[model samples]
Target chain A: MAALGFAALFNVPARCLPIIFLFGAVGIFVKLLLLLFGINIVFACLAGAAAIGFLSIPAAHYKHAPPLIFYIPAVIPMVPGIMAYRMMLGLIKLTESTQTLNYNTVLFETVNNGLKVLFILISLSVGVIVPMLLMRKESIKHVRVPFSKK
Target chain B: MDQAIKSVRREEMKQLGKVLLKAGTMLMSAGANTGRIRNTINRIASAFDYSVELHISQRALSLTIMDEEESSFVSKLRRTPPHVINFTILSGISKMSWNIVQDNWSSEQILADLERLEKMPHYHRWMVLSLVGLAGAGFCALANGSPMDLLFTFLASFLGLFVRQEAVKANFNPYLAIYFAALTASLIAGGAVKLGLGHADSYAFVTSVLFLIPGVPLINSFSDIIDGNIQNGITRGVNALVISFSIALGIFTSTFIYQFQ
Candidate 1:
């Protein structure tokens, strides 16, 4: 939540901060809950994304802003900075090591780290889009209808 | 009579196309994802009784707008740079797009609104810098660091941002700014590590650099690709990867120098 607040202060409107903060905290909780139930790491990320995506819809209506205005900033905290760094570090180490057999572990670790980051990203984006697609279809049905802050 | 009617329709198409083109460019400049940019233009066109054909690439946008009478069309082209994201301008444009979609205003009013928005001041620079530092500290806590580590991360990131802003103010390249900022931040944190200051974890050092990562480009890259915007997606993705590579290179250099000491 504090991470979300920090992000909101950087790129979001003051009035929309609280909702963005809430979306992130709850989204991470959803991820944790899925993990507790033995869900795969990729599935856990998907659940987290869906959680925020669902939460942001009503908030977007209230703020009269697009859901993405909040969604992207809120998700910043979860970006795998350490994993990416480790991937780079491992690759460098693999290159410097003269022993081919021992360096293979470094290569494996680098690829594994990169893959993990990729999967989490894929899950987050795909999960969020699923709800957005449904919502967009609903909006089109009411093309001539007047919009409300509600 | 038919020829006269077609010319009049063409004029309307041109007028509408100009406005729509401007909106698309603004959204792209403000870092809107590919999908949102396309949809916003579509919404605006539908509201105005035109259905538009749009083609967005890495460096340009083209739109063909057909008027309600279907008698004529106007096409527009704009060269674009994927400029840095600013939420204030983005929010203004978002509101304007909604208003346009709602059919609540005329072209004149929308352009006036856009004019004001382009001139609107964003948050104070010092405040933005502080908040960016705060974000780094928050990442420290998020990384499971101790309170001391959080404080250390805050101060390090604060100074890091100052150096970055200075580099930017001096008109250094964006990637260069990131490099200087990372080197400055991680160097300080590295000094702390050498001296074994506090109980702060080494993780806090990396948190100082997090604020400079290419979050928008990465997210937009995937979104564009998933939406089948292959060209723009690949462009954005490569752009992001380059920045990421820059950051990694910066960190590697700093750590490499530290090894010699």
Candidate 2:
């Protein structure tokens, strides 16, 4: 539902919504499954996004649309929105109070959440784009060139 | 006669240049990454036996289209419209570029198709509001908010997005609209928490404004940098950071207002 809503918000073509839903569902499932095994959250997100990225080529071929349309909204649901919010709130709190005790805790929360948001975002974007780039290279190499040597 | 041929070649170059610029602007404004935009334009130009050199920045595109013989080319620049996330237009033009290559479309035909695409309908306002609101609630639920939290989140984001739409329509700066939307959402959620309405008011408060996250810009910025479009990538990254700051300020204001209560 989150993916579908974002797809709509992005004005994705109506025909591609189902693929978005599929990618979203599968991506989250993979992440959750990895989390159940005690995997780190950042690595789990990476794995999930890689799953969606690998699936995007086939999905794009099937729909004849750009692979990006399928994965962008799907990957969004995995973004650490709450972490970003908490980080922002923590930063704000730090500014309001300068006492050493409160300052240390607020600073810790701010840094912790900030670092997690940064790494998770990096993992998500890298995980999704790297596979597409790899697969895309293979497809490009297969294109028939006129008068090419056998 | 030679002069006549030169003039004709110039006219042809000019026409083709216009077409390339139009296509580039559409893709850029639709939030496509720089590589895709460049690749698509190159593909379309190659179909017409021309090679293109393109420079894409955050606000404008500069294009030079040269014939196979490297004679009688045109160079043109066009400013892109404000960035909007419209994947339909992006996908439409991409598919059309492929079709152009396969079917050998004329410039006139391509222009006609572009005209058709420019008129594509967006989702109705009501649909976007409700769906985005639900997306916010979904985010809240994912954070383990209770049912009451979800309900308030839905209401908060619904009104927040509505305010954003109206603000955009009223010609406010886009960042200001985002700030207003985030403020509205956080205030609503904070109010619910203050009133003792939900078990997980903090979750609702934090997640109700997640709809405003600049996911596309942030992701595209990273993609652009990876693809070596460093200038474009940095500009987009800064844009995303500014938007994040706006959202944070909005949330901060509401939190500050309610924390003493």
Candidate 3:
């Protein structure tokens, strides 16, 4: 959850910071609750992304900034570093002939890991964007957030 | 007076269209989501009392503005190259876009605004270096690191981020920057572990280097694809994948060479 500090690190205006924090926290909380139910990881991520997206819509309305300003940073903490690492490790094993692990086993694991990472990426994007799609087209009426250049 | 008025209006449209495109180009280059890019540009044009017909592709942006006579349209196109995040400039542009929506800034005023937005000082260099490096320690903690692991993570992250910034500023390929940064971080983490630094496994190394991952592109690519911008989405997705592959390659090289367990 500390990784969600990216909104601040990315220099998001302080007025909009607290709400982005809440949206990110809610997203993570939802994902954890789903996981405790033994929900599949991809679905959990999609749900998390959805919660982030849903919450950020109101935040965006309140902050008068782009929905993405809140949603993208809110979802950053869930990008799944372990799956990416595993995928890379599996590929490494498959490429080298000297590995103690069998080549077929390595290949299978590599493919599985790659697919999982791809699905997670897909889920995160689709999850957030679905909200935008379902909502009314964004108009200029709400673009009122003041930003500091500092 | 009517003749003079027509000529002046023509001049205003020409300048407004040019600067509006300029703002859109920079925003695209900075990697704002595709949807926001279109909305912001549209708002700028509407502010100037011109409607634009825009065509956005993977590498370039093109838009057309109708001539005052309605018989022809003037078009402008620009190629956009992705750059490092400068939230100050981005946030400044956002404010400018809002101001355009709220005020009837003259064409020259809009042009000046664009220039000032472009010139806003970037965030402090050392602050970025330290905080981003601190993000490395944050990753280690997320990985359940011991205190020793946190120290090593901080050192590796800060050092690697410096090199990565240098490579990017030198206009090295994005893949090369990711690979170099990941390799540096992993080597530092692995070396510290090898020296009996009290870390038990190589997972800390992976976590330390995870900051090199391209979170923005990955998410933006998906956003593009979902927006039905197939060409832009695929290009962004490929770019993100290549960068991730480079990062993985760097980590694999470290593991292979150092034989980190």
Candidate 4:
């Protein structure tokens, strides 16, 4: 999964293997840090996003390719796909209970999953967007080729 | 006078070569992993005084150059008249393509090699698409859904391939492409759920959308800002957000319509 994400991110016509591997290793470290600090998934995601953003600077400076390849894979583990599925299931079960099933437990589970997906999406977006906006003024200059003297 | 004319033409050719190189680099970089080529060409072009006509083809980078015409007849005889120099740069990025050590090659040689590589046949586009599909499938499976949900997810993934291919061909706004894709995927999922495919349909929908996430750009933008690349960071951030929002809007629209119905 990480490899696919890396390939998708790099999606360019050059050698980004080194960059991908380096970012992947750093991502594991960030996950470790999150575990050690006992941070919730939302905060952990934010921390991971920040770490990836910080680590990508050198690669961007040295390489003209965008730093996205490194950063995207680092956050793949926390994207809330499962939670989203659960939310859908919950909604369906809730609807079923109200119709003919009369199952309160299904209703409760559905609500819980729906709320979880919402919270996760909100937090993930906040974690990603806040740091990005805060550091907006720091992007590297694209390498401009010198124009020849006529 | 003849000797002077020859010297001027020689200088013009050198400048023309530089322009073609620069144009080629730009086109190649627009595709993928050719940053070094782009930089090298930019450097060489900066040293010349020529206009460049860059064409980005689906398979290769084509460039045409026109030298600035001399004002005086004497100067015209002494230098080459402004004219087009056409050349193509191949995109040499494939699983089979390996990078030679930069230390062993001069910058000019590297540029030449990249230009050569651009002409080599590689499966970069297909490889990227295949990987994306595989990952989307893997994510869907991991979500622990029923087989029906998995099939729906796979269909969504297949749809994504068409979206990406169209986006690349159109050079349309990546954000717009992402949003449309998201909406389409969500709609399909919602319909499936509504039709009694089980709650797994929604999971399939969300998991499939995962394949379209601009995860890399979001990360890259943040990294660029932290590293003091304010302009690059901001541009990338905006671009990434546009795509993300597009995906979100797609979901919102689909959900809204589904609910309304």
Please give each candidate's TM-score. 0.90, 0.96, 0.88, 0.53
TM-score of chain A of each: 0.86, 0.91, 0.84, 0.68
Q: What DockQ do the predictions score, one after another? A: 0.45, 0.60, 0.32, 0.18
lDDT of 1 by residue, A1-150 (tens): 445534544466777877877777787788888889999878888888887877778788788787877777777776777787778778888778989887888888999998998888778777776677778777556543565322
lDDT of 4 by residue, B121-148 (tens): 4446666566666666656666666777
Could you arrange the candidates by lDDT from highest to lowest?
2, 1, 3, 4
The global Cα lDDT (0 to 1) of model 3 is: 0.74
Model 3 residue-pair collision total = 0
- Which candidate model has the greater lDDT, 2 or 4? 2
Off by over 4 Å in 3: A1-5, A97-101, A138-150, B1-6, B67-69
Q: Residue-wise lDDT of candidate 4 within A13-117, one digit each (tens)?
A: 346556655665565467568868887766665666566656665564455444544445545645676665565546645654555455767777777776765
Where does model 1 exceed 4 Å of error?
A: A1-10, A36-38, A142-144, A147-150, B1-9, B198-201
lDDT of 3 by residue, B1-261 (tens): 988877776777778778877887787776686776787787777776677878886578898887546754578888876755545556667777877667767767877877887776545667656766666776677567888888888888877877787888998987898889989988898888778884675556877777777777778888877777777788878888898878888888888788763
Residue A40 displacement (Å), model 2: 1.0
Predicted candidate 2 versus true structure: per-residue lDDT over A1-150, tens digit per residue: 788889999999999999898898899999999999999999999999999998988888788788889889999999998898778767767877979997998899899999999999999999889987898777555532431223
Pairs of colliding residues, candidate 1: none
Misplaced by over 4 Å in model 4 are A5-38, A46-74, A80-150, B1-108, B119-130, B141-147, B170-172
Candidate 4 chain A, poorest ten consecutive residues by summed lDDT: A140-149
